[model samples]
Target: MTGGAGYIGSHVVRAFQQAGIPPVVLDDLSSGHRGFVPADVPFVHGSILDVPLVARTLAEHDVTGVVHLAGFKYAGVSVDRPLHTYEQNVTGTANLLTAMADQGVEAIVFSSSAAVYGTPDVDLVTEATATTPESPYGESKLIGEWLLRDQGRATGLRHTSLRYFNVVGSGTPDLYDTSPHNLFPLVLDALTQGRTPRINGTDYPTPDGTCVRDYIHVADLADAHVAAARALGEGRTLEPVYNLGSGDGVSVRQIMTAMADATGIAFEPDVAPPRPGDPARIVASGELAARDLGWRMTHTLADMVSSAWEARRAH
Candidate 1:
């Protein structure tokens, strides 16, 4: 797995490890910590853009398939660092794909984002949703999906692209979303640091006057990926694109309420201006995944928030 030391990537690494499949990880640690990775797994502290390093890892490990979760995820930073996001998200994926192909790796599971849908008019988003990325970060992820699809079509490289929503709630004590960009992390940061969690806006079309987002617990997301990989191996050839989420749109206020209920900490959020390119609502349709991969999510908002709080308290 590439970028296996990062937040979501780390959890997926653990999932693979728990399944007794140790994957060689290629991470530059630009935004990941070595401590997050399991000791049994071999770690290569290098960028996937390093063609030689990636190729060597594939060859050395006899890599069969990859779970790719290495990419920028912040919408705000994407505006300031479009080039960086492009290089890291787009170029890096291209390089990794080339290396995988050269090493005879035939299949892969890509970690895409719901940002590819931009702002959907419909509340329930499906794999058939339009591709209109709202930021450079989102654009990069969409490009990666397209690249994966194109490669599969041209080279018989079977692939699955999972577009995840806000991933939170790691069941493990030490596992959670620790990235500065993730919503759950930012909330926890504010609460633990004696600062008020800030809300982006209070005038959205949502019932609570705040933007709504679909959140899938990290563990459930991990399960979905494993199931997707299994589906790949089943020769079902599912055209490789599925939206992984709770399929329930929860608003900002709803999250605060859940967090407060979970941690007994009053998250008095300071309302602020809207993010540059945020969507008002994004709910996913995991029905396709359920039908194709026999996958189902296991965590609700309350469950996710409470489990996240448990992980956060430990930190």
Candidate 2:
């Protein structure tokens, strides 16, 4: 698994270990922590852009398949750093695929994102949703999917991309989202620093007025990824992409309420204007993942908050 030392990647590493699959991790530690990777798993400190290193790792481990999760993931920042985003996401993915081809590793599970469907007109996005990415991050991911598809046709590579919505919560107390821009960490950081968590806007058309989005627990998302990898390894015909999401979504106000309840902080959140281009609602249907990959929303909204709080406190 590439990027196996980051927040989501670490959880997926644990899941793969639990499933009795030995995982070799390659990470540059740019945003990933060395401590996040299990001591037993073999770790290679390198970037995916290092094609020779990637090829060597695959050969050394006799790697049969790959779980590609390494990339520049910030969507808002991607707008300002388009070239950096392309280099990390686009060029990095190309190098990894090239290395895999050289080493005869034919299967991959791609970590895609919902950003590919930027500001969609539909209420619930599906696999068939027309991709119109608004940020370089989303565009890079879409191109990554295209690369996988093209490689599959040319070299008989088998692959599937898992496009996720907002991933929150924690499967283990030791692992949590550390990104400063993510909502969970931002709220928890405010509380820890003796400040009130703030909501951007609460006057939208939705029932709660705050933005509603699909937030899936990271552990559940990891499970779906492993399922996809297993299907690919077993040579089962799989779709090119699947959305790991809840058809229903939770609002930002709801998240704040859950945070207050979970952390025992009762102060009302401060309100601010909505961020530009912020959509009022963005949810996805996971029926396809459920049918093929055992995807499910195992954690409730309250469960997501509490687990996340516990993990944040531990950190």
Candidate 3:
């Protein structure tokens, strides 16, 4: 698995191990932690941009398939760093595909994003949702999906991309989202550091006047990747892309409430002006993934909040 040391990728590594599939990790550690990958798993400390290095890793490890999750993932930051985002997400994917083809690797599972849909018009987004990405990060992810599709057609590569929504919580106490731009870490970090968490806005048209998003536990999301990889390895036809989401929406205020309850720190978030282009709501239907990959939201809102808190405290 590429990026097997990242927050999501680390969980995916564990899932693959649980399924009795030994995984070799190749990570640049730009944002990923070297400690996140297990000590037993083979680790290749390098960039996918290095075509020769990637090809060598595939050949040396006897890799049969790949679960790709490495990229510049901050949507808002991506707006200011478009070139960097494209290089890491778009060019990186292209290079990985090139290396795979060279090494005769036939299958792959891509890590896509809900950002590909931007602000959807409907209440529940599905795989059929038209992609209208608004940032470089989103656009790059969409382009990465395109690269996979084109490669699959050209080389007969077996592949699938899982479009992730707001992934949160923890599968293990040792692993959690550590991105400086992510919501959970921002809020949890503020509270732990004796600073009050702040909400961007409370004036949206939504019921709670806060932006609503579909949040899925990271562990459950990781499991979906394993299922996709297994299906592809077993020669079963899978959809080109699947949205790994919960059909329900959770507002920022609701999340704050849950955070307070989870951490035993009751404090109202300081309200700030709304961020530009902030969407009122974005939820998704995971039916397609459930039908094919046994996708399901096994954790509840409480489970998400509490598990995240526990993990945050452990760190």
Q: Whose TM-score is greatest here?
A: 2
Q: How do all the candidates rank in terms of lDDT, highest first? A: 2, 3, 1
| Stretches > 4 Å off in candidate 1 | 273-277
**Tell me, what's the RMSD of every candidate?**
1.7, 0.7, 1.1
Q: In candidate 1, which residue pairs get closer than 3 Å at backbone N, Cα or C atoms, i.e. clash? A: none
Estimate the overall C-alpha local distance difference test score of candidate 3: 0.93
Between which residue pairs do clashes occur in model 3?
none
Per-model tally of clashing residue pairs: 0, 0, 0
Top-lDDT structure, candidate number: 2
Q: Give the per-residue lDDT digits (tens) of candidate 3, residues 193-245.
A: 99999989899999989999999999998889989999999999999999888
Ranking by TM-score: 2, 3, 1
Please list all clashing residue pairs in model 2, or write none if there are none.
none
TM-score of each: 0.94, 0.99, 0.97
Task: Give lDDT: candidate 3, residue 161.
Answer: 95
Model 1 Cα RMSD, Å?
A: 1.7
Q: After superposition, how far is residue 216 of candidate 1 from its true place, in Å?
A: 0.6
What would the C-alpha RMSD of candidate 3 be, to one decimal place? 1.1
Residue-pair clashes, model 2: 0
lDDT by residue (73-115, candidate 2, tens digit) is: 9998999999999999999999999999999999999999999
